[model samples]
Target: MHNEPLAYRMRPKNIDEIAGQEEIIGKNTALYHLIKKGHVPSMLLYGEPGIGKTSLAHAIAGTSDLPFISLNATVSGKKEVEDVVAEARVTGKVLLFLDEIHRFNKLQQDTLLPHVEKGSIVLIGATTENPFHDVNPAIRSRCGEIKQLKRLEASDLLGVLHRALTDQERGLGKQSIRITEAQLLKIAEGVNGDARKALNVLESVVIASDEENGETIVEDWLVDNLIGRIGLFSDKKGSHFYNLLSALQKSIRGSDVNAAIYYLAHLLETGDLVAVNRRLLVIAYEDIGLAAPHIGAHVLAATEAAVRLGMPEARIPLANAVIEMCLASKSNSAYKAFDAAVRAINSGNTGDIPPHLRDTHYAGAAELGHVGYQYPHNTPIGSFGGWIDQQYLPDKVEGTEFYRPVQAGDEVKLAAIYERMKEMKKNKR
Candidate 1:
């Protein structure tokens, strides 16, 4: 017990012992009632690593007094699952907590369905990836609504730290160690909302500190040193990677420069320049759009430079792009207009191309009534250059206005031009 990791030793024994995730485990919460009633159902827990998914599972088993068994999907296979099922049949039921359950292949995941459907196995799957995106639908269907555990708040982590320091049975309470509230807060906040990380850091600091006069004191500098370079929880293949990209784009769109750069730094840390670069370009064109149209070119150049430079150094250009994007005037009129056009096509509103608008480059185009195409370049009219009143869109959508520019940055001027063009077409008719 003394050799075990603090995180493992301090695992919550009941739902009441769990910290954070009040929404999921609060006394009034459905899950809390379910566990207290010993009605632990097959379900999936999805969230960032170190946020108590495994702890919650253990707590459920403890509170229910159900026979508990654990296996990691990454290492275990059909045979191991069969064994658990066999044991479950003898025990009437077993709480099987499967960690990294997304690693189970389709067939492996299928094996859990029947046992889970029957009463023999109460499946509690833990995954960092979004269960909807990564888990098999069959497994997901039996699990019911997937529960997402949020990252622990600093205050929640503070509670965890204090518990570990005072619990003599399973914690460092036996040691004559002293630490200040400020230093504890540092550990709680530094781990990026991971309770396990906070506990581990405290344990390391205690291990390194030398006892003097039967008292081991933790210092601020040592806490910082142990928590060096906080590793953010994200992987190139996980939903968290996409979430960071989404956050970066939203922050930039909302003109929050600080948040935008923060998300950018996290994305860069993943060493996935392709996802980062691609998402930045999308933000430039899709969010900034006609508002700061030139931003697309600038973002392209920055991303290109980032690809050439490669990490650590690549972050420089990426940072510049993120800042510029955050400050840029934002508009989604271009994308919205394109989406509208697509909606029209998707709804089967497409009509035949007017004969005059059809291609006339071939030799027999005139015979095929592909003539009468009023070339805009030859029949220029109005202040808008190369403007003509001939219909370009197919008949059903001929008069449909898709590119309705917004009153933002360059789009303001472009919108004015668009209105003038419409007016010119009306007058010509």
Candidate 2:
């Protein structure tokens, strides 16, 4: 039994035998229907580890009754890819599933495009990283994408454990091993949503049933793996990653300073610090603009300081920066107003920049008669833009208000000055 590979013996024989990933394996799916119609496209499946991507690909190949040639992109170079392509061309309908498909460099990935175009081989790829980030654009452009999700439900894990225990050939039926539900659930709870890890844990649990002499029993001192403790924290690059980050971003955006700091701490302790900094920078500009212009600057300075400080020393600066961003008065006025003005101009509002305000800092100034621009400060009436007949937002649309400012922090001061200037010009006109 030790000489035989566990995965080979345990691999699901058919789609019915496989568990999870019903999102892709369930009825009416593109892959399911295409296999039925005898017209399956080259596909790519992406998700966290132990989510059954390779199993699905193998099952698909079985349905076609064609030889499945599995390739690992990480090790295979361009020459190897070319050889596979040659074989595929000769076979005409073989299934080639490339695991870690994104690991293939651009040149290696390109080797498959021409062969794929000719339909010599059906290319199915499996990747762990987000396909949009990891896969070559050309490969993604040609293949339909199937995204697998991490194991979440404890019941789903229990299903795998039971199948392993009572599946006759696959389970412990070969030996006289008796186990209670408590021990099994403990192993299952420690599995961290990965079926392969769960099965491996079961094997270990059985082997150590009696720690001292290796005798069989339901009780033993079982050492927990890293994946086991991971289930306790709940975010070891799994489902909680996105949700946690989302809450962090919104915390800063909504100006909850304390909450933002708390989220930053959680990310630093459980997630990536660099990612937290990246989001903080975005939150600074996107959510807090001219109203609190210092927010973006503060975040950038904090990032630079963190890079210089490094590791343990960097934590305080990171927290301070995130707090600063949250404490900053919120404003999207500058961005919204700028976008509005641009939209109006692009929509065919070919207007002039009032002659009085046109660029006068040039060589041949007097020849152009660039004067009569009341410098507002010099005149009581202040002919701000010369004759008010000058167009600003085209003749069809005059008085298009764009830059409305929020009354907070620096924006309040700017808005007041801006309004006063606007009032004087409109009063004279």
Which of the numbered candidates is closest to the native, going by highest TM-score? Answer: 1
Local distance difference test values of all predictions, in order: 0.88, 0.72
lDDT of 2 at 386: 30
lDDT digits (tens) for residues 299-416 of candidate 1: 9999999989997899999899889888888889989999999999999989998998788778999998887876678866556568667788887887898887889888889888
Candidate 2, residues 1-429: lDDT per residue as tens digits?
A: 555434455667666666766667667566667775667678888776776787778877777777678889888888888888878767776778899888878888668787776778788888877787768888887786556555645676777777777666766556656677776677767766677777777776677666335436656346354234444333545445665688988988887877877777767766476776787788888788888887788889998788788777778888888777777788888888989988987998666555555678998765676655644344343433333323344445577788988898888988986788678668868
TM-score (all chains, Cα) for each model: 0.94, 0.69
lDDT of 1: 0.88
- The reply for model 2, stretches above 4 Å from the true place, is 3-9, 27-30, 33-40, 77-92, 103-120, 129-138, 144-152, 166-168, 171-192, 201-225, 228-275, 290-309, 312-329, 339-401, 406-424
Which stretches in model 1 have alpha-carbon errors above 4 Å?
379-383
